[model samples]
Target: MSETITSDEGTLIQESRVWQAKGWTARVIKNEEDDGWAVAMYKDGEAEAALIGPWTMGRDKKNPKPLDHNAFNTLVKTASEFVRRHEQQLHASLNKSLMLNADDTDYKICLQIIPDEDDPHAYLSAFNNNGEQIAKIKVRPDFKLNPSSAAKWLEQGFQRLD
Candidate 1:
């Protein structure tokens, strides 16, 4: 239901929800000090955001460019493409931490991949049910888990060696 627009200044501004079904929403705020707009994307039921970034600005300084029909259409296309790429990256990261036990409920493991500066790799964190971190793995953006490792984990399950 929400949409994103890229300013002529090469900044990507998003003014829509990430997903209508998830109820995740976002708004673009212009920084007065800097000529940049900050996008805050948050889920409806959560206080924190799912994603945030700076949108590029448009060319021509006389007046802020308006979102006309053509501009709106182009913006939607560009923004959707960005969101799709991000979603794919997230999915690939999660797949690296394959679920061990399909029925066990006592121990739970989840993976979180966060982007970092100075490096293109994503910081992967393995967490336990109590939210305690189990392991941190720095993986390349395009890295994929070996099938053998995934199978081994599935058979052995997770252990709290810590």
Candidate 2:
């Protein structure tokens, strides 16, 4: 099921049914942007989103093709399935891998994923032993983290002063 919501910007957004998982929830928002519309899947009630991407544009540019009975039904099915797959992958990558290492006091590292608003990438930040940031990596969510790179950083043992 989906419902239309008016955002603070006064844009009319059609929101999909909420998909909930461990520590996270996702919902697809349609008609939320000027370019076309977007699907934003984020943690429940959080202002900062984990993921937000543009939805497919309709054939007509001026006006979106009306959602007829068949179209609306098909869209609901397809979008829901896609959201399910995305939720699973996001949970596995973020919840499983990224964390603050407490084992090595001299080389303590913290990893964070910050989603960008104007871009389709996430910013990965690495902080060192003193809780100071050392490096920032721009990564696509689909990009796999190179284990070699992580290992090399550990070997170098550079403590981030700031």
Candidate 3:
């Protein structure tokens, strides 16, 4: 049996096979492919495993090695990096931004894609140096957000592109 831990966000964290850590849980489960064992690392509140790897066999050559603080810490770091990379990739895919200087003023142009099944679209927006919104327009999901494209839109008085 394993002990369950929870986070402050009301998320059911990891099931500690031996030692538990904050915002993380480690579990040793039967491998889905063969009769061997595998270790699973789960982040607090997430419904899916963040990292999964083969469990090392113990010195006895009969069972998996027991979890310890050192092993758990290493798993936490690896799993955290995995989650961070995933988030960065998702952000890059869904949003694009560019900064342009015109009339001695810097403005940030952003395009956010909303991939709704019924109606997919992208919202193009601009903000001044003060972070005040200048204009926002709904455009095609495939709209490109780049320096040249943004400069053209600014030259066109921020009008909707047909």
Q: Best-fitting candidate, measured by lDDT?
A: 3
What does each candidate score in C-alpha RMSD?
A: 13.0, 12.1, 3.5
Best-first order by TM-score: 3, 1, 2
Shift of residue 118 alpha carbon in model 2, Å: 6.9
Q: Which stretches in model 2 have alpha-carbon errors above 4 Å?
A: 1-118, 152-162
Given candidate 1, what's the lDDT at residue 99?
Answer: 39
- Against the correct fold, how does model 1 do in TM-score? 0.34
lDDT, candidate 2, at 1 = 42
TM-score of each: 0.34, 0.28, 0.76
User: Candidate 3 on 95-162: residue-level lDDT in tens?
Assistant: 99989999999999999999999999999999999999999999999998888999999999899877
Clashing residue pairs in candidate 3 are 14-25
Tens-digit per-residue lDDT, 40-79, candidate 2: 5455456775555555555776433333334434445554
Name model 3 segments beyond 4 Å from true: 1-21, 32-36
